[model samples]
Target: MMKVFDEYRALSDDTLKPDQPKAKRFIEAMRKFLDKKENWTFWLPYILTLELCVKCGTCGEACPVYTASGRKEIYHPVYRSEMLRRIWKRYFTLSGKIFRGLAGAKDVTEDDINALAEAVWRCTVCRRCAMVCPLAIDNGLITREIRKIFDAIGIAPDELKENGTRAQIQYGNATKTPTEAFKDTLEFIKEDIEDMKGVSVEIPVDKKGVDYLVINNAGDYIAFMETVMGIVEIMNYVNADWTLNTPDTGVNDVVNYGLFYSDAELVAVAKAQLETIRKLKPKVVVIGECGHAYDSFILYKKLYKEMYGEEMPFKLTHIVALIDRWIREGKLKVDKNKNPEPVTFHDSCKWGRCAGVYEEPRRVLKAVCKDFREMYPNREMNYCCGGGSGFAIMFKDEFLKFRMETYGRIKAEQIKATGASVVATMCANCKGQFREIIKYFNLPVRYAGVSELVANALVYK
Candidate 1:
């Protein structure tokens, strides 16, 4: 039983010290804010809304962490919420007065804060639990709000806080890759495109009047340069008018993880992307092979409008959708003979499930690969890679093992059963996660984006 909470329990040792001035100030502010709110306004509303939660454990069953971690209590959806519920009641609820035990009220110590921070950060907020919940309670959203409270109290996980601040303040990305590195990467991709296709392909930077404004993260350049080169090759082959924003090209700030909790910072970073797109005024904004970036563009567009008082004029399209459209429009030509071996696709959690971009990438894969195989559970129902929610960067070590044993295990088994030589996906994060897992397990399979495979198979004029 104790081992079940091992990952979660270890966090308590870093509990906030009561003597810290910042901790004391933040805690006092929270207590006073909760008290000022009409008991029914925010506090009771949240409690009453959450109390209807039947604890059917549907969410527990849906969480990737719970599934991968073997149904541990610490990974359970209700566990953290239940713990917070007790603390809320002990401090604020009147029912906690006469029947404290019945209401499950408990005082929130510094240890409680630390434990809750760890528990909440562990979740990816993928919202898979909401799909399984009969009441649509959205435990993922609750987890995010819990994270918000932690952020307010200055007790967020060190990695999350540091990365979030770096994203906002430093190089405008969590990884903080230098602008010089970004431009050098572009130059490298151009050289690769020339070498592969026998043509010098130009990927324009910050060019106005281009039909599409493409924003990609530095990850695309460093780890998945093939995909970046692929996009350029396809664009050149198709004669599509597009430009990359070198100055503000990194819109992949969605992994900041803070956005899942902090609305203000989320809006600020989202506005930065929009501002870049607005400067170009392209017909469409093509989000490169990153999923969460598209989430920010598609999901938070309205939020941006509310803040800025006008809707963005550009259309947000994922790169997969763009590639699929190119294939359909007869712009990019693929010769399946180049990739004669069998291949399977891994659906990205954000792109496939959250953003409903399942079919476009599959269509692109079907065109690129001679044989395309499906996993046991396909589309929206597919399991997470355990690294989907920024775990690829944050808890790389633990997430690598977890992904191989769980999501990657399933994917590898499916690929082996199909006798596929490669696994292809559209999302950059998926590419990294799958590639690492395949390497660690010594699986004889190469992983790439659908665009990269298509680019490799392209029949150039």
Candidate 2:
């Protein structure tokens, strides 16, 4: 029965505690990160967002963070959004320069930045707030900008910057999963596919001149190998000229944790993935069931134009889209009877809000599952899994408890209300989040990829 404000205040001890000796350094770095002239010149969207927000309270009701925290006033979207907007006005506005006090401007401190930094992490950057706002103020974008400012000051979670962005940029993937591991996993998947459907097909790798080059999170090879097998089965059934790169090739996975932490790191990691695509020269890049990866590739196209002065060398398509295309073409057939159990879909924030992909995964699910229940307030209006940012991976004890108890609890209740034995999602992060919730809360539900459900219903040719 702890209030959300109290729960968040507890996080302040750890998350908002600035290094007192380096307070000046943090302030300086924060300003530099927000510097309009050099580091970040694209400020018009941010400007419109800041000037546009009217604080009408529509966004508060729309936000999952606010609702999920049992209507916590701290998680209210306007709280952090207004803080950044005021900070911008205080330093960057002409009105503030002439009449600071009249303009409601104040000199912000290191402590202020620390509190805002923690607030940024509290949000999942789900963009639900903007969807309902009359002014189209994206608090999610504002939250990310705050995170970038923190990242510049060396104040972000180490899991995202170190274990995720740096690890992937320096060595290819977050785990640096071995080439042999990829090969071995594919071999096992092929055998499993044969055993299940009496079908056998070669898993393509490092092959040149294919129509598509697909990549997934390396975690798939470790735990959800069935999803990988699903992909291979559908690819074979569609007669796709697709390939998976060797792990040594440094682009086998398509995740960029930098999307959560900073723009610079997102650009660097995405450029690396694009380089591999350039080498392979595929017509399109298929990003497998990871929501952020779809978003990263979309961002990459813009970054590529800015850096290289041209459109990207390849195309990027979500795996859900690819499957939907095949189904529409009558190329990959599925039997709905294969999955008779009740099912529900969780629309990932990146898929619906970030990427405008609402129907593809749902269409596939409907075609494959007999009893597909819709989560209320679904599609672009759907709630977050509470693991959208690094919360799923960054597990400091207090943060873990907050994510489970405060943020993830609402989604659990939604699933339980449906009485669904299985909840399916396209994003690995969503699935991973729910997997933990299933065990920790001892819920009757389990998680599955949308692809896995389709694979279950696949009628092999």
Candidate 3:
């Protein structure tokens, strides 16, 4: 048996830790995982990446964590992937069988499992390394594979599993918002929007045959009410038909934390969300202000076809893209004077790079802000807010420290260089991370969602 490093084991609330897997269990899990032919198509590139890496060190330079941590060897982009490669060589490769420990092949041990488990979480899995890779290898995909193994063996982060996806599955949201509470939250938001923005917007719930089925991260209702308000205001302004799934409908959040580690969890959550979507019967589904939610649905489309032998019924679109089109088509008039301050955007990895949603948010920002500054490397090549892959919510004390000081340091520097008073991001995770890092580093910047900025600038006549 192997105990995880102290930092990796601590829960976000500091109250409890889940059981760690033993060495024998880890070996069995890996053996079963590698042998499964169903997973080969998914994992083949990871195996190829292992064989293809040439130690060119270009990926290391592109890694924010490695560069921010002063190039720590352990935090290298390929550091953990290299460990998996060695393990594969020792246990499954012919060369390793013939020349064990002779050419960088090390036998798998409890320490390796322990060390590898610890190393995997340090990454945001932003795939910036893959973008810069000469051979198109993705260290991020390899990292997720390693994480999937530990997650299957019951050794994954508690925030991502028990308290996250499980809670979402049970209560219709990751925050454990019950049926009554979700209804009450909608009521409160509707009233708050009327009071604050003077807009009497009806938040439609479980309304059948709507043109759009709008979904958001459940956390937004609690922590980012403005984002939800913005969506409501915009939807109402355009007089578009949309409905939110009530808790009784068995869908509350768009978050699929399963995308971080486990495919089974991904499919399970998607299945649950899809159950609600099918009930509501909308023409299209809109994802609101969440990056992983947007990316996971794209993953789910493929999985849905494979599992059910048909295409996902509804067309998918992002809120930013919708807002941009609304502005271009003059459906919503906006006055930039309402937001007369310097602003910059922090692109969420999954939304911007993975989903190719770069230009829409920028167009919305330019439409709503007086002074919009560009972070040096904007769009697809942008750096992560360092909170990708669910690390923003993993609030363990040591992990928190590493996130603020190391992982998020480069982002803070970028924000500072932009000299923007507010950094507007579309994704909830990026907003949360920027909020923390701004406070942690004491930077003179406020975090705002693109929707919030748009709401502020909406020309109400």
Candidate 4:
């Protein structure tokens, strides 16, 4: 058996060779694209905007990988951005060519390719850096463009290549689980809900005329089945006319990991969900506890509009916000006594930071948990769990350890200080990562999704 270090080493070494035909083509394409002086119109805005960056290193301090890696030179935010900046300078600025050394312009050699590949791909694109940056430079967008440049040359990381291809070819979702399996997973959740809550929840799959269609990430179906059950329970309890589209139901393919650049591929994924909504002619679309799903839908709404020639017909809502609305409207009632433990909430990167969804989850938690305490840097400033952007599946051991040692360290300490026995988060990804980190640290705190807590606290009369 290959050791863990050996496995990662082998995977890292799989980067395309400089002399490879595909690599040559990619470099040529990138060179041509960059060389187009007219293209400077598009590039200048970002460069000019970035020039205002004060380099206060606030973003550097906010990065989970940088913190976990002990602020290594290669993991620094400026280091990766500088790599792209140097290349941009060489191609776009005349001074860079005449005084390349002074301008920090360096040729994109094989080592640079490998280093760029490794460095950019390591980020979860959690946007914690952008949240802290004074200029809001959006390093995540920079990383995405870098991935696009690398992908044009067929040099994406193995995990990205495998997952992206699977999403495109298999179930049309990144998890690659078949539609039948997805249906079965829903059936299993229905059964579990029946057993746990004595409620028969009907999760409509592709049911037409529903008011809303909920899109769930496959990870929630498989590992966090309770969350799926909780969603169904709540929808059923409130008599909300919602359906799950099992046929191409897995639509959370933000694949922001940088493997896909074609707008066509992204639209294809977005359209699958929209098609379901269109067929059902739902009044709105409610994206479930998954943050990236909302980001894919709301933040990148233009992709769908460009593809289909109009905006998504229905409104889009994050599940937490929907729950909060329902609670405030008296559509749902919860008994906080069931969740008497003191609790704290972890803000999900996609929900809290990227999408600016801060208070909804807290509202849901405050209603469900008797005692709720805030993490030190809560909301948009919360640390990433280090296992996002497909890192949970790709870099299992290292990412999990990183979560425990860094992101979860402060969270765990906060939970301990609060004397809370549970930690709740609205995002399925955060719930998944926290479960692992809490178990690894043997912390007495239990982790639950805000929906799960609400489901348990339902006061049905």
Superposed model 3: Cα runs more than 4 Å off: 1-21
lDDT of 2 by residue, 107-196 (tens): 777666656766787888888888888887788888887777777766667777777878877766787667787788888889988988
Show the colliding residue pairs in model 1. Answer: none
The model with the greater lDDT, 1 or 2, is 2
Deviation from native of the Cα of residue 25 in model 4, angstroms:
4.9
**Model 4 lDDT tens row, 254-350:** 2333222333344555566555566667677777777666766764476566567987677778667878999999999998898888888877787
lDDT tens digits by residue: candidate 1, 1-461:
12222332212224333233343443554464354242222354345435678888888887766776677787788887786677667756788766887888876665566556556656667677777788867677667666656656655554545665445445656667666766787788888778767887887777887888777755677778888788888888888788876646435333435455554455667666666566678898788888767776775578667767877677778778888888888888888888888888877778876789888888888888888888756677776665565555554324446556655665566667767778887776677777777787788988887778888888866
Number of clashing residue pairs, candidate 3: 1
Candidate 4 matches the true fold with a TM-score of: 0.87
- By TM-score, the best candidate is 3
Q: Identify the runs in model 1 with alpha carbons over 4 angstroms from their true place.
A: 1-5, 8-49, 248-256, 396-418
Error of 2 at 212 (Å): 1.6
Candidates' C-alpha lDDT: 0.68, 0.78, 0.84, 0.67
Going through the candidates in order, what is the number of backbone clashes in each? Answer: 0, 0, 1, 0
Worst 10 residues of 3 by lDDT: 9-18
Indicate the worst ten consecutive residues by lDDT in candidate 1.
Answer: 1-10
- Model 3 lDDT per residue over 1-461, tens place: 22354344333312222243356666667776676484663667766787789888889988888888888888898777888888877777789878988855777777677777778888888988888999999999889888777777776778889888888899889998887888898899889889988878988888888999899999899888888888988998899998888678887799999998887788889999988888887999999999999999988788778767899888999888999999999998999999999999888899877888888988999999999999978787888887888988887656778888776888888999999999998888887888789989999989988888998899988
Q: Estimate each model's TM-score.
A: 0.87, 0.92, 0.95, 0.87
